[model samples]
Target: MGYSRGIGIVGLGVISRAYLETLVGHADVRIVAVADLDAERARAVAETVPGARALSVSELLADPEVDTVLNLTIPAAHAEIAHGAISHGKNVYGEKPLTAVLDDARAVMASAAAAWVHVGCAPDTVLGTGVQTARAAIDAGHIGRPIAATAAFFSAGHESWHPNPHFYYLPGGGPLFDMGPYYLSALVHMLGPIVTVQGAGSRTRSVRTIGSGPREGETLDVEVATHVTGVLTHASGALSTVTFSFDAHASEAKPIEVHGEAGSLSVPDPNYFDGDVRISRGDGWELVPVSAGYEHGSRGVGLLDFAVGDAPARRASGELALHTLEVMTLLLESAETGERRRVSTAPERPEPVPLTTEAEWRRIADA
Candidate 1:
């Protein structure tokens, strides 16, 4: 099949499978190359993708036909891969947090700008119907004025099931850094940008035992907080109380809730693509219909959106990711210093995603 764009993926980790499933045979983008530190793994994956070749990371970055690099590297390697891709004059789309540190993320944005290449980041879950529907309701003033919100994501930790969960205990792997992107990105999409953050955190233990995987029974040192709680002050003056915990066994808290003058909105888990958004007025709760976003969206939809969308229309742009990173890192700093941290960046709210069905987006992709 003819394709409009070429995607060279760097990193064949666990997350790569999701992107592979989404982009491998898609009509709009071709998987031109696959690369990983484990050359065997890369070649194995490449063999499964029609017309795709396995190459070294450097080779993939310099490939003439590779228009964009799909970076699925670890957090620490995000900046390196992005810089390499930008230096090679290719657009890039990567998994969340943008980078392990805020300054690195800023550097990435600056580099991409100087190179005139587009950089898109994930937690594009916000571009899906679950979050977008809630965003639409707010934009339409169905909730009057958004005043406050609550975002909660609790889990025991990734070591329970993930084959390799050591990273979850590292600097960029805490609940907030690993999972905050989903909730925070969705919040920014719905409530606009954040201006300040106050945070507090706790660590339940210094070590975690691997419950599954080949490393089962092995212990991993915890280098960051396992439970993080914070209050984000948005540019719109709306406050959101958030609690992200890897220490918790479970919780019944809704993934997100926005309380406004007219009513309260129950947003679904921002990690997934779609869910029912409910609203509660004085008359009681009612289901808000799915009024926006790509129906049946997947992992690579953001990259596809980046490839097909005009610059101003890219909802998952690097600017948004950088701003999101600043918020998260600043929140961590605030937790350590016991002082509110002011956000340094203010990216404009992205253009809203209109209600687009699966068939519609598929047709658009094919074009």
Candidate 2:
């Protein structure tokens, strides 16, 4: 597919800044337009990108110059924005979880298919060096057959730092939904799609107080589970014990660990793209040095690279987004029903695009 000069970006929120910084300097992408509910916010962000105009969501969708619409809105609005973009004949790149509701996600997928517009999601972080190196090692049988795995994401709460943390406790914003994509994406990349899930969940407290930021000491109501634990049965018959906790105290541990018959691999925090991939053998865990050619601030650049044909479309595809949504939906289902939820979706394996040299890395990095 031929690359467009630039893509239009919607939602000029805090998360969109990282993407803007990366796009401004890239030769492959141009920031054509920016839209937000807050017109002032959209105008402010538009000032930074050359030839970019501020528009309402409707206006941006109507703009003939926009080939792809990058949806960076909150979880609640993801489905609406993606559907609108697809309906207007523009490809979509949305933030994680795809949508808060399973039906909405399926609807968005169906819309993208009928429109023949490419639909993809974020947390393409797994495509970075950290997770990719681990995947390569596992695929080479360096870890032998996988046996079991464990992953955890624990935090005090988002009320402390996020400007609007009320939504963090909402349906799609809890620890599991908020941070689960990062961990789960890495897990699936290494272990394949999960087949079944059995779990338990609870809300430790109904109300939480903000610890910092302007809302410090302010109280907020929590509607979703603050603590959750589950067992995931992978297609390979490997079982993974996963836990997500928003009520817990601080802890110092990598969020994911995969155990195989021969050895184990420790993945760095998936929230960010680049980190070390450690391996365990006769000696204790040894850090496997792998360099992610891309810089840290370019969070969404990898996906943009894939989209523009500057690099191979190794990640950030719609199938992966659907699989991630499936895993998350079933986790919640199992917790609510107190029974093992069987997943009907299967994993789709894309041919591996080799990144064996510095030049290969440069092709993606420099682009």
lDDT of each: 0.91, 0.79
- In candidate 2, stretches whose alpha carbon ends up further than 4 angstroms from where it belongs are 1-3, 291-297, 310-314, 350-367
Best by TM-score: 1
lDDT of 2: 0.79
Tens-place lDDT per residue, model 1, 1-367, is 2556999999999999988888876778889999999999999999999899999999999999999999999898999999999999999999997999888998988999999999999988889999999999999999899999999999999999998888888987899999999999999999999999999999999999999879899999999999999999999999999999998886999999999998899999999999999998878889998899999898988998898777787999898899889988988889999999999899999899999888766653323
Clashes of 2: 0
Model 1 weakest 10-residue run by lDDT: 358-367
Per lDDT, the best of the predicted structures is 1
In the range 1-367, model 2's lDDT, one tens digit per residue, is: 2454558898887888887766675555667999999999999888877789999999998789988888889889999999889888998888887888878988888888898878878787777677777777888887899999898998888787777788788888788888888888788888888888888888999998877877788888898988888999989899999888998889876688888889999987778767888899758978876743343424665556556743235466666777777888888888999989888767564334344343333333233
- Worst 10-residue lDDT window for candidate 2 reads 358-367
lDDT of 2 at 165: 86
